[model samples]
Target: MKRKIGWVLAAALLVLLAAGGCAPKTPTAKKKPTPVKTEQKAETVPTYRVVADNNLDKFKQTHGQYRTINYDPQDDLVSLLPESLAKLKKYPQTTTVRAYVTDWQQASVQMGSKPMTVLTVQVQKVLTGKKQLAKQEIRLILPGGFQPYGQYDKGSIYHDNTIPDDEPVLTQNNQIPIPTIGSTIVLPMRKAAQYPAKEYLAWLKAAKLTTAYVPADAHSMIWRCNPQTKKLTTNNPLREKELTKWAGQGNQTWATQYKRLTAELEKQL
Candidate 1:
């Protein structure tokens, strides 16, 4: 009877051991950690506090687009002259128009309830294929009025909102007819205004800006001047330097011519 009891106890012990072995495992230690995202933060966007370009942001644009919705378009003299001067050879009076960026024209260029820069623009020529653009180009378009006798003296751009009081001025545009009415005037001067109208047109045609590669790189910069349309588009270091030097020289020349025209126009007025 003692031996039989011992055998039964051994069998029970074996069954208990088997059940314990079949139990689920307590998980092994893991070293893989969850990654923390850093790139999705808000500070990555590009923004430049370019208020220092000429301290242009000093004033406020009171007559906003929404606020002045009821105002007559005729009330603006500066905006009126460019179109009006289409048929006329000279300005009715000795007028000056200042240039500014398109967006901040009212607030930044405005003077104590007045505008500091009354600018103008005209499309000389538009070229549509690929053209090269230099590092420094004049981006601002002025509607100051362009005449055979007029010029934009970039060298004499003295004050914060001042254009060289005299220069061969032209507006910037990429479309329209060749040698469009007021563009190539009979100045009897070799140094006349020119815009890459054909190149600009080509750019418009192919949906390109200056070249076949696209103007993606230069899209953000201020256009120092429209591309010279005559050349086959290619990046040229000399071209860049020449553009800057030529602009200075051209502006100086225009200053001399401006003095002459201002006097001539003043006498006529």
Candidate 2:
């Protein structure tokens, strides 16, 4: 009986050993931790502010009392002849027209000691002109950057600044509090003209108008027609190239119209 019991115990020990040998082995090397990735936030940029003119008091004293002149398309002269036309014969007089300020920009050239504003205006009615120029848009460069003063939207009444004279002032669209037309103020404008009607239609067939801006200057070669004379005037080559590049980035419609007007003029050349 004792021998049988000993054999039984020995069998149990063998079973336990076999179970231990079949078990999986533990790992010897330690596992590495995963690296953490960090994300960064982007920085924001601020808009530029126009430096306020400190000469306001002096300007008021010199120019006299501040009087707001409301815009009146019917009686006010809104467009002026280009400085180039100042000496030209048969040059047309500055005209009064009803127009809207579609957009505005800072004049690339500075005035006296301050920056000027260039307003993009669309003509709605021609109050006074030899030829009625309606449904046209042109650029007008004013004396100062008036954009900071008020909102310039489609409905804003853009009138002459009478107190200082010649400068432009803006009243909110649909809000014309004053109802007076003071001494007329004319905007420095680039007038658009076409080849004579008889010549323009025929010229469009064979030639195309290409419009571009004159560099460092607001004038567009596309808007101005070639003088009636066949002689081509010499231009500053370097300046021309620069303006062309600048116009390439501006309003394409304005450029296209300029090109069309220019192409018509070029036919005469």
Candidate 3:
């Protein structure tokens, strides 16, 4: 037993010695120098271009971003309008109904809330024009009513010589109620895609319109219907261009000015 115990002790000692020799060498116990981390610079953002090739999604994505939007000169409408007006102008030949209504007592009745409400309308010309050059029918869309500007009307100012500007500007105070005249009303020629000529012809008669002035270059005709003395005019930009767009270089301007000139021409309706 004593011999065995002595042998076991010797084996343990040899193992310890072997382990010590195998241990990783401590080189003067030198501390590793702390790693110096180079600071990384942030990536630079891109600069904006006027023709940013911005589409609907991009415009929405970058609307409130820090960078300002660069607009093209031909896109003058965007810069001139307030956010709401700009939104409204996104549609062509669209008129908004802006008016109000009210009561003597309770501001809002169960049937309604405020004196009025502004509506986003869809106006389209649903008819084919002279030789299909223009669309003649106009659709007045009033989803609800006039959007209220304020509580008390400040006063009415003249908009044009056609109507007195002194009309009382409505306020929230007055019990008077106003109706949205026309906020978004349009005449789109694309309607023929969905409805055929005979269909629109039926609508034209129902709406009391005519095909009187069928210009050769026009998609639709401008007619004078004596029943309501309603003069229906076809809204055609291409026809307007053929008639009004001057010589070279002016063609581009015509497409831009087409809306305004078309509106004026509609008065001849």
Candidate 4:
């Protein structure tokens, strides 16, 4: 009976091993690695030009280190339009011309707290004022061009009382771009003394300029003419309003003058 029981147990074990061999195997799952996170930095864009003494030195040797100035002028439409009209009346020599900015020189004289940037423009046509200035090059000393910056002391006449806190404190104040070389512009100007006669003459001799002029009214009087459309425009918003106001006034003389000037500007190259 013990031999028969052992044989039956062995046969049962063999049958169980056969069943295990015929069955399919289970697949094991692999553990995936956690993904890594990366951080990206943002790029910065420059809104305005930051000029320094080194930049002015490229044109001429500068004497002092560049200093930040409160250079924002009271250039609102209300202030500018009346002031401009007064200047136009005072200086009847104010002429409108289409010109090309050939080159520029940094003058020694200071406009408030900065050295003036003088532009040498070749007159292509005279829209108003002297007709003889056509085909001649002239110099214009404007207030707000690229220049080494400085500030007046408190209570000083030149001190800018209303400079905003958000305004950039830089070595130069170029509210609008200095007219680039080879770009065409339509400008209204008048003969003016940037400095005393002796000083002005010395600068003119040194810079090789015969005479220097100034904008008739304000920066808004300077216009960049579209080459294709021949439409005149200004980058200075306050001056643009001043121009528009001056054009829209009830005075027929100014309206007539503005019309003639625009017509002449359209005819130029």
Candidate 5:
């Protein structure tokens, strides 16, 4: 009975082992790794534009006063008043003027406690306030701390001051030079009605006008005269040719009459 019981127990154990071996095995699935996320930097764009009419009032307010040099044939440096200028209703008290930059001086101004740059330009032109200027040179003051954008020589032409939309604006470096030099710029000028003429003269004298210096080859549209009207006009083709020739030959007398007018104005200034 013991032997039979042992055989039955062994048979039962074998049966259990067979059943365990025949059972289906389950497979485990592999997990995928999460991808890393990355961030990108944003690009910077310039928004500043050259000062224009839209902001001119604001600029004047912040800058203190808006002043411009008047091109007068009588008191300023001018030899012969252009017919166009002479014919204008406001000839001597013009709102606009063209000039040639003969020299530049950087000055320091004490505004409150901060020292700032005041650009003084020695210009030669034919018009002023009193009489025709004869080869005269005078110092004109730009009140703000104006710095030029590019290099300029003695003979650079300053057309008029007008900031166009296409004009380049200040960069991140804040190194933009004045656009009036080296080109014909149409700058809008404002009369200082509140300031007396004597006061204006005093301010100019304080600028310490540089020594008289004129380039032999310097020629500007200020000397051109319209043949048809026989008046001072910038549109004279013949005058342009003559100016070009004089400039090529380094002739300082090409605008002799006009330059002489400038001399008288210099004395008055």
Candidate 6:
């Protein structure tokens, strides 16, 4: 009786295995992939301050403003005009243009690490020389604008100055004010190729420009003008001296030179 019972139980187990009742079941739900997170960086703000070259060191031990760092000598107009005209023949603008500052950038000249101001000007009128640049936008580079601030002692700020030197501020030499945007002005311009390896000729090659312009001289090249009134003035003291020199030759006063210059430029136009 016991042997028959065991054989019957074994048969039942075999039948259940053949029917696939013990097989593993497939998963009911699929897993979802995790999403990735990306990080964003913030833009850095630049700090800048304008200071005269003489009064550059104004912390702890104060630097006097009396000394001259880059003083321009009085120019003789009689000699300057002929030489300027001859040089203009080699460069662009044997002519002058009345333009407004559309935009500007401060950069360092690679050769000497000197500061320069690159201006984007829109010509409003042709004052003298030629009319080709009239109503055209152009670029001009000039010396002495802004330079990277040098390292100075920060802990020695006991005297009077409050700012720290190592704070990464751009120290601009404001002896000649940077031409303000939208301000009308007159420029006597020339190609930068004349100053190969010295000025902005090689530095601006990355811009892919055919060429760029520069002033004949740093002092008298820019003249601030009222767009509506057409009154002209310059920030450079040497420019006044040159006009005074011209006035002296004509038996007139320094103030009269402004009108005379305007008349001369208009006659050329």
What lDDT does each candidate get? 0.27, 0.36, 0.31, 0.59, 0.35, 0.55
User: To one decimal, what is the Cα RMSD in angstroms of model 2 from the true structure?
Assistant: 20.4
After superposition, which runs of candidate 4 have C-alpha atoms over 4 Å from their true positions? 1-71, 75-91, 145-177, 194-210, 240-269
- Model 1: per-residue Cα lDDT over 1-269, one tens digit each: 99999999999999999999998999999988889877766665212123322233332333212111011123322211122222223433221211122222311322122221221122232221111221111222211223211222233333223333333233221111012111111110000123345643442334212211111111111122212331121122333454457567775452343234333322321
Q: Per-residue lDDT of 1-269 in model 4, one digit per residue for the tens?
A: 99999999999999999999999989789889888988686665221112222233454443333334434654453322223333443446577788877666666655445556677777878876788999887887754333322233345576454664334333333344466555678877777654458866665566454467877654545678876777877646544565567667855554455455445556654
Backbone clashes in model 4, listed as residue pairs: none
lDDT of 2 at 19: 98
Clashing pairs in 6: 95-129
TM-score of 2: 0.24
- Candidate 3 TM-score over all chains jointly: 0.17
lDDT of 6 by residue, 184-238 (tens): 7776666676666633455667443336676664454567787566566774655
Candidate 2: pairs in clash: 155-173, 211-259, 215-243
The whole-model C-alpha lDDT of candidate 6 against the native structure comes to: 0.55
Worst 10 residues of 3 by lDDT: 98-107
lDDT of 5 by residue, 63-159 (tens): 4433322221122223234333233325434423334333333344332221223222222233434233323333333322332222111133653
Question: Over the stretch 46-90, how does candidate 2's per-residue lDDT look in tens digits?
Answer: 111011122333334544543333332243322222233222213
Model 6 alpha-carbon miss at residue 97, Å = 0.4
List where candidate 2 sits over 4 angstroms from the true fold: 1-92, 130-132, 146-269
- Please name the candidate that would achieve the greatest lDDT relative to the true structure: 4
Worst 10 residues of 4 by lDDT: 45-54
After superposition, the stretches of candidate 3 with alpha carbons farther than 4 Å from their true spots are 1-125, 128-150, 153-186, 189-269
Q: Please tell me which model should have the higher TM-score, number 3 or number 4.
A: 4
Off by over 4 Å in 5: 1-97, 111-131, 146-194, 197-269
3 against 6, candidate with superior TM-score: 6
**How high a TM-score does candidate 5 get?**
0.25
